[model samples]
Target chain A: MSAQPTVTHKKRVACVLAQFDTAADVIHAAEKVRDAGYQSWDTHTPFPIHGMDKAMGLSDSRVGWIVLGGALTGLSVAFVMMWWMNGVDYPTVVGGKPPFTTPSMVPVLFELTVLFSSFAAVFGMLGLNKLPRHHHPVFESERFRKASDDKFFISVEAEDPKFNADKVRALFEGVHATFVEVLEVLEEEVEA
Target chain B: MAYYAPLAALDEAHLVAPGSTLAEVTEDIASVTERTAPRGWWIVFLGALSLLGIFGGTVGYLFYRGIGVWGNASPTYWAWDITNFVWWVGIGHAGTLISAVLFLFRQKWRTAINRFAEAMTIFAVICALIFPGLHVGRPWVLHWMFPLPNQMAIWPNFKSPLLWDLFAVGTYFTVSTMFWFVGLIPDLATLRDRSTNKWRQRIYGFLALGWRGSNRHWQNYERAYMILAALSTPLVLSVHSVVSFDFATSVIPGWHTTIFPPYFVAGAVFSGFAMVMTLLLITRTVFKLHRVVLMRHLELMNKIMLLTGTLVGYAYAMEFFIAWYSGNEYERYVFVNRAFGPYAWAYWTMVSCNVLSPQVFWFKKLRRNIPLMFVVSILINIGMWFERFVIIVTSLHRDFLPSAWGMFSPTVMDVTTYLGTMGVFFTLFLLFIRWLPAVAISEVKGTMPQADPHFHGHSERSHSEHDAHESAVGGDLVPEGAE
Candidate 1:
């Protein structure tokens, strides 16, 4: 907390970016970045590079727990909704069965459980990833488009206390970065 | 023809074409969307559009003339509409089976086929829902299917299997659509990046939601995908089971059997694969995607069809055994009526197509035969439809009292509306492949050998630098000299 930088509305530095040619290169570069102790950085690739998670020193994802919570919520909602509708609210009998047939309610219960879990899975993933945040300073780099095509990249944010532009460039160069550059935060978009 | 090699034969089989690169995968799939519509695409589009028009016209007229236009009369109340509903819903299962089930099973081959099959599932489900909507006669009051508080104040029966089906199919549709869209996000970003024009960039970019392929995102994305797959596996199985319950819960001898759940599921898998193979074969050729959609993938799907088809055959035989062994006269009568009664022709067609036709896959050569498999695939679809017809119509038409027994003959409207759904299916499917990457591009790339950071192809020893990195990085990756 003590390392928090002073606010400067006119600050121009967005991030330092590095590009690599292969999955292996990206993985090795990610490992170097991890060893260098840059907290705010990510490796980008056309597809998930298999070993990059370990290389980047990431912990297990929290998505499973979020999904579990979602499933439980769904199960609860289904139970209450069915119980109130069938037993408490509008009671009726059909096919020689009593109202609030627990056995028959199983399908809807399972459906809602899965439904809410899936919602949690998708939106939980997006929220965790801070996605649907369409405006990001990283997109300003022309070379970054290749991150979704045939190339791999690493971007260390300027917000990181360890992120000195020249030092980041030197560290990337020490590894096998094919390219390295700094991106500036445009003035009007800083509020976002 | 070179016989399709099993994946165990390391010399021949590869996940993709032998030497395809990452650039090539992106280029191959993305170009399909970017390229101008081919002549064959236009032909199919026009044909499917006309079919869609027929669907629209028929539904409009049906809404005007009411449900009396169809052949739903006394005794045989549920006919082609219900039969098509089950058939189309059955066809929808292969998508989830491929995408969610195979994914959980770690079947790498599903990558090339899952997206294509999943789109098929959505379109098929839409087609299936049309039957029930129109079958109610009065379409305007369809909201009564839900438990809504209105003037009548009658809540839908929670115990009814019909209501259970609404929840099942509805959840199945919503979850799978979300699953499909979630999967599409990364691929959409690729299209956005590759776009040559403003509109393509804007649309694809908006859909992509600014996916930058950050490793932080992929970790969660992968976990979320896994959870969805886990959820969908049971959801897929339960969907067909609940659908079977629509009949299984009934006392209509043939429909009342305990085996209906597993039977319908097996039949769904069988018919769904047939539909997938039918569509995939055309898509593969038209799009020139033989490299990714390999003969090996087709052979694997054939093997699934063989297994499920055998299961369906067993269920058919077991139905008669149960009927006779129970010593219930009505059960025996229904079985006898199915095989030797007036609708015996349909019963035999079901047997020949659903049971006997798939047995040809016992031979490796037949399993790998493209033209033969295509024909069998179409036959199996027809057979599965007849299987539904046999269960619904035969069981209902012949009652305990001979006075109530009446035959079911589909009216022209029934026939046209049934075929019209096909038009709706293909029109949606064609537009899907045209606008979107029909293959899961990123997933395919992930499965390739080179996607692994540690994979150095056959020349692992040549990367001596990797030896140092391995020591430095604590060897958390795959072991040295991995294939």
Candidate 2:
């Protein structure tokens, strides 16, 4: 009768995530979680929740800086390549146009700039988000899979400095989460 | 209250269908790909495959012989090859227009058709690239188009519009495929989660790139999508303009016109829309996707056809007027000969089909008539091919020296090759429909009223208040039990 050893071994509670039906509820829960001084938390939804950045206290994304960097690199590369190739290397004047004609060079310059910037935008976004990750503690919850479908969820991780399991569970309850769960990171999954 | 009634009703009508849920949208669109191919699909697939076989045979034979097997000769060296090249490339433009330009403009209706159009853009560009590849005859040396250093120390003419074409089309294909794939990620996730089969799940799961639809990911995705769309807008416009430069940069009278860029762009959009309409009409019927591809969508496309068709007509008229007004004898001669020369039949056919045929769309009844729209779409496709034929063949046939003039007629190879490419286009298109989500599921889901968190009771409230109210009433807090 010693509480049946509630578990045979110690279990790691990764995060306490709650499901909310509407975008507003998740936004509200997010605001409450933010106000509660939780640093490691996130909301998952089927689409981009408008103004959720403000709710989560996030600053503007760093993706634009990356894209701009790429664009400038592309422009420079095009300029140097065209200058070196046509102007210096194999300077054959055709149609009476100058070998290093700026006008003729614009199309390639513009095209390469766009190509590089686009590559940067896509890969940069993926890198910033840390995507292609097959496993997350949040995914351990069967109910959490609905995040990509009709449900919205806010997950406050155990890694948060202020994370106290009981307090976080109560916090979700206070926000009237329809379903609340504490995700566990299994030993095997962690090892794998 | 009375004043708000109509606005509310309009908003209600904009919902995909009254009372359609997010789950229903996902199920309806995904189920088409999940299910077995229907009888019509097999029929069309076989027909397209047969045509693809013809294409393969024609290409093999052409390779065995040479460029001499076709109708290309001195002065008219650029015949059906260049014509089909321009035609296919032009058809690809409409896809970019619908996806990038309309997205920037915030036309939500584009969500319904953008996926289909973008796929068309990719496929059309593939068919287009083939012509330029084969036209070199010695396909092995086609790499010479690139500015790579060679043993001969010969570099491609950087100033040549043909070189510009290589870069334009190469960039267009890469950017378009990236745009289409990025847009497909979320929808692929939906399909992956919904699939019951293990292999299907694994494949889609891999393509989804472990997307969990986290708000963080959505934020980055939305920003990336916006950036790509902005990038693609200029790219699309530049692609056709560069294609026009292919001719305009040359000294050929009909080809060397300042108005070619805008005229070519408009004609590209016109023909692209016509091709989209034809495909969509057949698609909606075959797949029973009328609810998704609505009559409203069809009518809107028809109107675009009408608008762009008029722009093209005006360009044709201006070309003639400018030729006459400028008193450039060569330009005037080209224009007059185009209308009343050896190819007068082809030229007038272009006029009637492109300019006159679209006028019927001014009447809403005709625009909405599915059969009439289909026929008109086909007619426009034919007209556009003829338009390219008129531009390339007519202009090249009788150049500055009438002594070098010759009437160009296609050999069986030319006809089969063109037909073979059509076979190639349709074959790929059919396969695409069978395998992929024809309509973008996640995007179309966003168009529904239920997509908004604060949307309730046919009205919207401030976010904070709505959140407070939703949390207070916790019973409705979970959506229909997670699927």
Candidate 3:
């Protein structure tokens, strides 16, 4: 039988950038986005945009799990090291204490666990989030520099399948988003 | 548009007398400009300097004459060296806890005390380095702890807790120093800006690393700070735990207990907090930071002291009970002798200072009262030092068989080393206060109720939806680079 071609389209999240004078504009836009049933939408501001997490329907991150996993890995290594040292490498009976008792192993084990977990938490967070090698595409916009001072902006990704620039600009207009414009992703940049 | 004018009532144009400039209203701040020191301050500084001089001389003498010159001998090999080591290391803990742990917990009040605490960490660690440096017979071969290819071609025993101490202390000092200085950058910039003349400006400006408070600069600074805090929290806890391993992993009857790690950490926090209170009580009075620092911070720290003190007491009881229950005569004897031996007075003082004195803090009135807490903190410090003494000396004095047991006492040199360390600690602390902004101004400003627009009853004022470029991650969403 002839194979049927599967229909799949790339997803895009159209972001309407805004320079709101007051935080209330940001909140109102967030509410409007939520009402429009945009599940993959988010709001951006200079400082923390209060109540925006609820507006966007986002959940807590799994960064804690990454830390916990790293910590456990560290603890296991510590246990193995202790067991090899006291019980195997140079076993010397002192103060009539057992060579391989768990109580004596507790301190080193606990320390290694914390050491590894915290290390993992930090590096893992940075790695998973893909940070520190600092170049970003958003720097292309000249007006974007004003985002630091008095300006507030909202960016919707063009990669979302539903993110039609025209549709988003229209949506932004409906919500009274002044200066709504397309954030073009060049074909070469997209391909790269 | 007057958008840049501060909204605070005190920041208004006419908030002061109509004719008075903003400069004149804050003239009290300006008056400290003269380069003359108060005689009292000079006396204290000179006294600290002289003690520091003696410390240098004592260390030099010990190096030339050997560790045998100190009081460490049979039955008390660790006496003052180990005791002071533990005490100094314990004193270093509060700064990290105040800066990192409190920051993570979102306690904004830590800003007032964090800088001094951090400087305390660095100096206390420097003081701590002296003991172990002199503990081993050949102080010249101290670099043997580092994994270097030397004439003897020997590597340090990683299994040995002493080597672990080398690693732990070195790691701790490096990380803590980095954390402290990274936090000081913005504050250093503030100091640079405030400096009137060329010399101070040049010095502070160089130290400030060209920080300009740009949003991009603050973004990067915060990222680095968050990373450091995350790194240091575990490093601080682990370093002390590893330090406890110097004893816990040993076979010295009383010292060979599993409870030592948590016990040591709790004791470290207890002593560290006490030192903070001591410094803050004096500094707040001297520097007129009373209104800024406030009573809430002191009360919070006292509550912490009470909590840790209780934990320390519980650990002590558990150790005794475990000793008796283990059916080991040597272990049982070690605990019994600590309470009734020749140094029973020291032991009881430890109990009363660490256990009983902190009990007063259970009352909110006592905790909030500065003078009372200051006294309690000093007693707690005395008690904590004695605790380390009891741990190191009593356990070593009567270990294993009776024939090897002997009493030990600190010589005059031993006392001088400790006195010298106090000098070093205070001198560093004074310099830190004079040079750096003692508070994290940006973090503090961020926490002000005014920073939250919602607090000003203008939640609806933010609704001016003007389209602008933004990302979900907020203002500066630096996109991921290609692999």
Evaluated on chain B only, what are the TM-scores of all the candidate structures, in order?
A: 0.94, 0.93, 0.87
TM-score of each: 0.94, 0.92, 0.69
lDDT of 2 at B471: 51
Question: Model 2: runs farther than 4 Å from truth?
Answer: A1-11, A188-192, B1-15, B457-483
Per residue, candidate 2 scores C-alpha lDDT tens digits across B1-483 of 001122254554562665666666777788888999999999999999999999999999999998788889887899998889999999999999999998997777788799999999999999999999999889888878887889987677767888888989999999999999999888788777778899988998889888887777777788888899999999999999999999998889899999999999999999999999999988888988866777888888999999999999999999999999989899899999999999999999999999999999999999899999999999999999999999999999998988988889899999999999999999999998888899987787677665654455233332465446655654332432121
Residue B155 alpha-carbon offset, candidate 3, angstroms: 1.8
DockQ of each candidate relative to the true complex: 0.48, 0.37, 0.05
Where's the lowest-lDDT run of ten residues in candidate 3 chain B?
B474-483
Model 1 Cα lDDT, one tens digit per residue, A1-192: 356555445648889999987677788788888989999999898887766677888999999999999999999998998899888888888767789879989999999999999999999999999989788878989999889887889999988988899999999988778799899975543221
Backbone clash pairs for candidate 2 read A21-B477
lDDT winner between 2 and 3, please give it: 2
Candidate number that wins on DockQ, 2 or 3? 2
Candidate 3 lDDT over B106-208, as tens digits, reads 5666765787788888889988997887787787677776755677644433456776677678767876787777676655555555666889767866776
DockQ of 3: 0.05
Collision pairs in model 1 = none
Candidate closest to the true structure, highest DockQ: 1
Query: What overall lDDT, based on C-alpha atoms, would model 2 receive against the true structure?
Result: 0.85
